[model samples]
Target: MKFQQVYFVVDDSFRLLWIGGEWDESALANGGSDARSNEVLSTSLLSHITDEPTRRATQAMAEAVQDTQTALRIDYRCDSPTLKRRYLMTIQPMKDNRVLFVHDLRDAQTFPVTFSQWRHQPGADALKCSFCCSVSLPDTDWTPPEVLAGPHPDVVDFTLCPDCEARITEAVSALRDGRKPGVSTTSGYGPEGTAS
Candidate 1:
C-alpha cells in the first residue's frame, strides 16, 4: 500500500486542526469518506474514534507525551481485502499542549486469499480492536480476521481487546515514567521492543 506519510494536528482539547500528506487519498482508499480532513476538522478526535477504550487510551498516550515532551511510537495494522498493511504512528508533543500524529507506512503484503469486503454493523455483538483489527466473538479469544473461519461479521463494536489494552497501558506507563517507548514489528499493536 504505497501510502504517502500522513499527518494531522490537534488542539489542546483534541480537536482536529489540520491534516496533510495524502490524507484524502488514504481516507478514500480506506472507505473513510466521512473522515476526510474537510469533513472532520474542528471535531473532537473522540468523535471519530468508535470505541471507548481506544478513546481513553489515546487520550492517555497524548497526555503522557505532553507531560514527558517526548515522542511515543506504536505499530498498527490497516488491512484491505487483498493487502495487509503495517503502519507506525508517532504521537509527538507540540507547543501549546497540542499534539501531532504522524503515520508512516512500515510494510505491506498481499493476502494469500482475498478477504471479502467487511461492512460495519451498528449494535453488533462482536468486538474488534480499532487499532489492530483483531476480532472477538461472544466466547472466542481475540483472533485475527484473516484466520477467522467464516466471512467477516456484518458489524462489530470497535474497541480494544485485552491484549491491546495491556499494550497501551505498558506504553503509557513507560512514557509517564519518562521512558521512551520502543518500536517493534513483532506485534501490530503497541510497543513490544525493549524500552529505552
Candidate 2:
C-alpha cells in the first residue's frame, strides 16, 4: 500500500495535498486529499516548522522564475522540521502539473549536523569519544565553504570525546612530573628499513 506525502499548493485557495507516497493502495481512504481546511492538522507539523525558510526560498525562487515562461525552475533549501540538517529543494512548474523534490544535504553541506548531534547520534563521534573537542564546519565559525549549493552555515566546533580526554589528562599529569609525551623510535625504520 502507498501513503501520501504532504504538499502545499497555490490555487484559488491555499491548499495542502496529501498525495501519499504510494497512490495505488493502503491508506485512510476517507475522502479526497486536498486538505484545505482551517482546522488544525491531525498529523505532525514538520513542514510548518520550516515555514520561514521555505517562504524565503519560495519568494526568492518566484522572483527568479517570474521571467520564465510556461515553466519555473527554482532551487532552494531548508530543514527536515525534525532534523536541522540542510535540504536541497527544487521546484519545477510543468505544463499540466507542479513538482517539487527535497534531498538531504549531507554531501552537499560539509557540516550538516550540529555539534551536539554529531556527538550523540549512536556513533563514535563527539559524543562517544571524549577526545574530539570539536567539529570544524567551515564558514560557520572559522571558514565557510567556497560556494554552497544549499544554505548550510559553516561551523567549526570541538567536542571532547572520552579517550582523548583521558589522554589529555594523562599528558597533563605526566607534564606535572617533568615528563614529556614520548619519543619516536623508528627514524625511518620499519619491517623493510630496520635502521636510521
Candidate 3:
C-alpha cells in the first residue's frame, strides 16, 4: 500500500511560504476551504499541529534549524478523528528558509507482523508483546506480528503492552508450577484461581 506525504516551505519564523504535494493539499482541504486558504496564505506551521507536545517538539526543531542551518528529522503521531496517523517530518534548511517533508506511516493491512519482519521505519510506533512478539491492535488486543507483516518489515518497532506483559508473567508462573498454561487472569480466575 502507498502512504501519503506532504511538503511545505517555511521561513525561519515558521510562517508557511509555500505548500505542495497531494497529501499536503488534501490535509489542508480536510480542515475546510477557509482554513486551507488561510493555511496557504498566512498560517504558522505550529498552528496545524493540535497536540501541545508535538507542537513544542516541532517548535524546538524549527529553532534548532534556525540556529544550526542544518537538516533534521523527527517523528510524531496525529490522532484526529479522521486520521490516526504517524509521520516522519524532515526539515532541510535553505539559505533563509526551511523545507519540511511529512511522510505518512499508517498502513494497517500491510504493516510488518513479526519482529524479524520488522524494520525501523523512521516514523510510526507500535505496542508489542515482549514474550510472544505479538503486536497490540488499536482496540487494546494483541495479535501475532506476522499478521501485519508488510513488504518492509524493518521499518516498524514495537513496545510491550500491559495486557501481554501480564499474560507473559502468568505463563511463566504456570510453567514453574508444572501445570498447563491457562487463559489470562482477566478471563480465567481471581487471586486464588477462583472464577474471576
Tens digits of per-residue lDDT for model 1 on 1-196? 5755788898878898988887765521223345667887898876766556777988898888888888998776767778777777789999998999888776677988887766555567887676677878888888888888776676777777777788788888988887656863335433433233
Q: Taking the candidates one at a time, how many backbone clashes does each contain?
A: 1, 31, 15
Off by over 4 Å in 3: 23-34, 37-39, 78-86, 104-196
Model 2 per-residue lDDT tens digits across residues 1-196: 1112323332212123333332222111111123333432333222332223223333434333232312232111222212322222223343323333222132122334332222122222112111112222333332122223333322212233234344444433443444443311111112231111
Off by over 4 Å in 2: 1-14, 18-54, 63-67, 70-88, 95-114, 118-196
lDDT of 1 at 106: 67
lDDT of 3 by residue, 100-145 (tens): 6444443213332222333222234554332233455455456544
1 or 2, greater by TM-score? 1
Following a full C-alpha superposition, what root-mean-square deviation does model 1 have from the true structure? 3.2
lDDT of 1: 0.73
Clash count in backbone of candidate 3: 15
Candidate with top lDDT is 1
Among residues 3 or more apart in sequence or in different chains, the pairs in candidate 1 whose N, CA or C atoms overlap within 3 Å are 121-155
Per TM-score, the best of the predicted structures is 1
Candidates 1 and 3, the one with greater TM-score: 1
